[model samples]
Target: MKIQQITKEVSIKRSVDSGTEEQRKTVQQIIRTVREQGDQALFDYTKQFDQVELTSLKVTQEEIDQAYENMKQEHIDIIKEAAANIRKFHEKQLRETWLYADQHGSVLGQKMTPLDSVGVYVPGGTAAYPSSVLMNVMPAKVAGVKRIAMVSPPGKTTSLPDGVLVAANEAGVKEIWKVGGSQAVAALAYGTETIRPVDKIVGPGNIYVALAKREVFGDIDIDMIAGPSEITILADETAIPRELAADLLSQAEHDMRASSVLVTTSQNIAEQTAIEVERQLADLPRYEIAKQSIENYGAIYVADNLFQALDVVNQLAPEHLEVMTKNPFEIVKHIRHAGAIFLGRYSSEPVGDYFAGPNHVLPTNGTARFSSPLSVDDFMKKSSIIAYSEEALQRNYEKIAAFARLEGLEAHARAVEARFK
Candidate 1:
């Protein structure tokens, strides 16, 4: 089979998608008004964006109870298991600040503190991913966040997705609001009459939600401005065509603009994988979405060698990357960028997204080169503690004064000089 031609050159700008621009601008306006007018603005936007009218902005306990009553027991059990696994994985990542004392009475240490509260934004755009609820909320719980609040746009008449409420209940959420979209983000970032503002906001949503997060970043912390979903498979002759095909199809179902690429050294393996993809697409329920995603951004490149495939992956820095080859370990070390690296065929992207101990809330669109997967660290802050004894201060006061004087800051020099003067 002939390998497909690569793009003339990598789109360094990565094609800034403008399809959602109109919605994004509308959302921004909603966020601004929501920030100024509070619950009234939320009520208005909920009607406009979500096509719902609501009496209350917060989901009542009675409503949550009813939501639980309506859901099937089997689904509840599955959510329970997923939450437990997610909590277990994040628990291992929790860390404590440390302190050290020198020979003198000076103490040097960092005090780790959790944010007072964090807001989780779950999109109610057509579906509810309980997995996302667990992934976003569990980390804050593990980090010891004092208050965890969630917001999701309710259906027309302000009704939340059942699974979202159930997942929040399972994850120990303190409050759940009947709001979604950019307006909800505004309410979280800037406190409303009923909803208290939080120190950080996280979770995924559509482009409107993404841009809203970007705008409100400084007012309150945000995890990341997520891009479209992506996956890249690095394979050679030893890989299974069918399994590779399944992996590619998995990410393709996320959105039409999502990218899925296969970089392989062996022409034979590349040909087989392509055939495998077509065969599997026939049975996929989300075939149109998967097909469009693959056709628009998908590709199979014939690398000169296995090393060449590795180089390509490093450059792309895909959100989900899989290495399926004779020695996956040898390839893993050279991978400089990628949100999550799945080694060997058994370690599929779905595994990490669901049950794996590592967080599925990862950096996307080449941001992995500098950013990282959501972790306990994101919810915690460090404050340095420094204490110098009188003897130590006397020893170093002149030096400190001299250094401050060199910088031409009399106040700084005076502060140090006063200690010994």
Candidate 2:
């Protein structure tokens, strides 16, 4: 880890991978093939990429039940509890269709409607992401989305991880597909013979998945193109060095591109944290990945004071921020940007990642400066409702016509005039 004096120019922003031209071309071809061949394309891609020949694209209820049998009862209970917390949190974000009448005898407002269907892509490679399933699907379920389809790349056994299956079941997702990568994204964006198209697609994936989402964006709504994981810790003299190091590494282990930064007012704390990060890297299960992440992207900044430290934090606008100051609450008010704030020592980043009510799917790569975490709103669409009474139209029709005429839209002007006539 590198230690440096905090400056206004300090930045942790990494260039987002837009995929090489070859990869983009590959993704485009895959999407085109899926559109043409449908289920045959999905099955063929699954065989080529995942090395699994599947008779069917969807996961059966029997497989889901067997997934339960494979997992211990205690693990199942934990997944259920986590799902409950996620659902409870997202349910609060649900809004009802609303309208208001004005003095002009016009009813105007917005109607909130959940999407008819949604697709959630859970990546499968070296590890299982049951948490991803819960975070992405629960919000759509809370928004009253009728159908939530989940897709994950199957392993050699031709099935998803037990935990991923259990999480989907707990999250109330009935449609699970045993396919992933660019092909799965294509299947979601365009309907297959078996898998129907979804109105929106959400969840994280590899570069190919991201590219597929980008290609199909206008056709179907998609969650943001996520970047690598990031954690920026803002601490003071009262903060413990070891705890800060541990928290930083938690994100570093996620990916080689993941960034872990510490901004503090204490010079001693900065040096100690850098040392502790190196010390802790030796024991992490993903040791090489974390070590490389720290060496390349990790940093400890020494700030003159709390205000200066906060300035550095806001500039980074990290996806996950930990405030380990003496008074975390006071510091929070000053924090203008952060996807998720974990205050105090007890509120570790992983708490929000797994068990906490807040959605762990957050903005990364400094997007927190303008973007927000995934929420129920992402799964719902708003329709503007405008009802102008006869009296109101009589009063405003001329003004509306004149406005339309100014914009060179005579048809629009005539339509309002015809309404009045």
Candidate 3:
């Protein structure tokens, strides 16, 4: 782990990842092929990338039942518990159609409508997190989306993770596809013979998946172009070094590109945390990955005071932020950015990642500055409503026409003036 003194706020900015040209070109070609060739292109790519020759693109009822049977009872219970939490949390975010009558006898309101269909992409390979399935799908379910389709790679083998399948089943995913990579994204965006096109796609994946989402954005809505996972700890002398180290490693093990940073006011705490992180890193099963992440992207910045430390945290706009200070509530008020905030020593990041009610699909790579976590709203769209009575139209017609004429468009002005006539 690296330790440095923060002279300025900008110095704490995490590394930004804009996809490489070659990666972009490869993803573009895959998207184009999937759009044109449809399921045939999916079969070819699955064989080429996943090395699996699939007889069918859809997961069967028998396979889903088998997935449920294969998982241990405890694991299934945990997934169900997490799903309940996710559902409860997202249900609160559900919106309703609202309208109001104005004094001038006009009605103005917004009609909240759920998307007809949605696609969720879950990353397969060695990284199989059932929590992600819950986070991405439950919101769409809560928003009243009628069809929720999921796509995940079968990996080198033809078997999908039992937990992922079980979680999907619990979340009411209507369709499940056994295709992945850019091809799956394209298939979801532009319907293949086997899979129907969805209105929006949401979830996290590798570089190819990210690029594919970027390519097919206009064709369908995407959650976000997520980058590597990251966490920032704003701690004081009150924070436990061992707990902080564990919190940092929790994200570091996600990927070698993952970032874990500590911004503290105490030099002693900083030194102890660095030592603790090294000790904890040696014990992780993904030690090599965590080590690489810690060595390259992890850092400890010593700030002059709590205010200065928060300044650093805001500038980073980390995906996850933990305030383990003596008075975390006071510190929280100063935090203007960050996708999620965990206050106090007990509120570790993983609690939110797995079982907590909040959606773990958060903004990454400084995107927290303007974006937000995946929620029910992402699965819904809204339309503004305008209904005017004869009198209301008469009252506003001249004003509208004048406004239109001021823009130098006679045709536009005439549209409103015609209503008067």
Give the clashing pairs for model 2.
none
Best by lDDT: 2
Residue 278, candidate 2: alpha-carbon lDDT? 83
Off by over 4 Å in 1: 5-15, 18-25
TM-score of 1: 0.94
* Candidate closer to the true structure by TM-score (higher is better), 1 or 3: 3
Candidate 2 per-residue lDDT over residues 61-127, each given as its tens digit: 9999999999999999999999999999998988899999989889999999999999999999889
lDDT for 404 (candidate 2): 99
For model 3, the stretches where C-alpha displacement exceeds 4 angstroms are: none
At residue 285, candidate 3 shows an lDDT of 96
lDDT of 3 at 261: 95
lDDT of 1 by residue, 377-401 (tens): 9999999999888887888889998
Worst 10 residues of 2 by lDDT: 6-15
The reply for model 2, stretches above 4 Å from the true place, is: 13-15, 419-421
What would the C-alpha RMSD of candidate 3 be, to one decimal place?
A: 1.3
